[model samples]
Target: MRSETTPARPLGLTFRLDEVPAEGRRFEGALTEQSLGADLPGMVGDLGYRPTGPARIAGNVYRSAKTELVVDGRVTVGVGFDCVRCLADRVLAVDIREDHVLVRRKARVVEEGEESQTIDDEALEEPDVETFSGEEIDLTDLFRQDLLLALPMNPSCDDVGADDCRDLVGERAPDEPQIDPRWAPLLEMKKKMT
Candidate 1:
């Protein structure tokens, strides 16, 4: 699905060094059904009016002279996984709190000899909060990450029964009996006596 770019979000955060607050603020938004679409990692198909809970996101942005914006937040999402027994649909909830650091590469005026360690511009452009651009950041990728990690490794919902998958792992067949040729005459004599 088409997603909104970093610049397309509401003008909420500028992430300037001077304008940044000493205490970080809280950011909130909804990860609507349309937002997830078919791109969701798990088999999160729309099963007739299934509404996922409103995901909550809270984080703090710390700004430094060397770095532009540093953000940390907790993200929680509700997931639905099918039950292993009885083929029932089970609801699983997962929470992921990720920390992010954003560096203002555009504003960097460091000398060639200055040896500073920080996340580069390309890294910051990624979706998750690991890093973000100083110009503008989008949280859509961060939301997607949490949901993907919460899904189950196996998709089957039914329990495996013993009868369905039982065989002594290393069983061998019994050897066949061998009859003596002399026994054929003895067997005929025994039958005549009877």
Candidate 2:
């Protein structure tokens, strides 16, 4: 007699539903920068944040329903970017918590007399929901999106007193008179009135 078994998955952020146990499956792995492939580069380019090193992901996938899987995880990554103020290269370590629901796509069969229904606007706004047709659940995209969103919008070198930053400050010497040319006439009138 042959027993049914779940297919084995290589180490990474992908899991097959059949492999997940009734109690849930826990996974831990590190994804190198090279392993992330081309999509990562494009996403980094668009977001202006570059990955400085590999990312570590640890998570649990639970069978919430017969056709749904719930994924909860934490991601730790190092990101690099040019400082918005100083223009110096800055690196930041980011940690993000991810939670999502993956649902199996149901085949739609419309009868000749049956009318098709469209999804409502409220359904469109649900951020944690995703649909998959195959038995495999790939969490790579979800993890990447979470990491990108967790990055700071304006990264800074945090060295405002440095020489490079001082050059950009545009401060004049204490003895120098700082005045706008347009206000010269007003200054002259005030001096005459005094």
Candidate 3:
């Protein structure tokens, strides 16, 4: 093993700063759930979805400033989720065009107030701002985050009456209420008033 002074190597979906070309660099790659680490796969978060295909990222990474790299790209992935109406397995094709994703130094991001470094509820006042150390930039988490954001709040196979979702879910018979016989008269009277 190397000495304590030696810096650890960047792993997984990371790009060392030295790899960038003078003009710019075009990055094209796929991010899998495994490569993204423990954060992905199976039921996750409130959305309760998982990736069914690789997250494809194609973009141009240009060093706009010494402390910043400007990235423009799109992310496409197929996500598997249970249909809200029928609970059937369904896939959603997610496509997000990221006009700009910044890979800035940690200090630079903090100065701009785009994000907070701490995880405490009080401290998390803003959304994430992708930051990289001086040596390398890792786009793995960014890809995963974008994928999750693209998912719809209510996911289902039905769109415009597909699979009779409205008829099945919306028009179903209401459960019979088991009230005391003594309250039956009041309930009927209440129903009549409505």
Q: Point to the candidate with the largest lDDT.
A: 2
TM-scores, in order shown? 0.50, 0.66, 0.59
Residue 179 alpha-carbon offset, candidate 1, angstroms: 60
**Tens digit per residue, CA lDDT, model 2, 1-194:** 65985743433577678877667778776667765443233332233456777788988888888888888889997766655554566667777788888777665676788876433233336646777767887888777666655554344555222345422675322322344354355445444544
Q: Which segments of candidate 3 are over 4 A away from where they belong?
A: 1-12, 35-47, 106-128, 158-167, 171-194
Q: RMSD, each candidate, Å?
A: 23.1, 14.7, 14.5
Which is the winner by TM-score between candidate 2 and candidate 3? 2
Error of 1 at 34 (Å): 2.1
Off by over 4 Å in 2: 1-11, 35-47, 118-125, 158-194
**Candidate 2, poorest ten consecutive residues by summed lDDT:** 38-47
**Candidate 3, overall lDDT?**
0.57
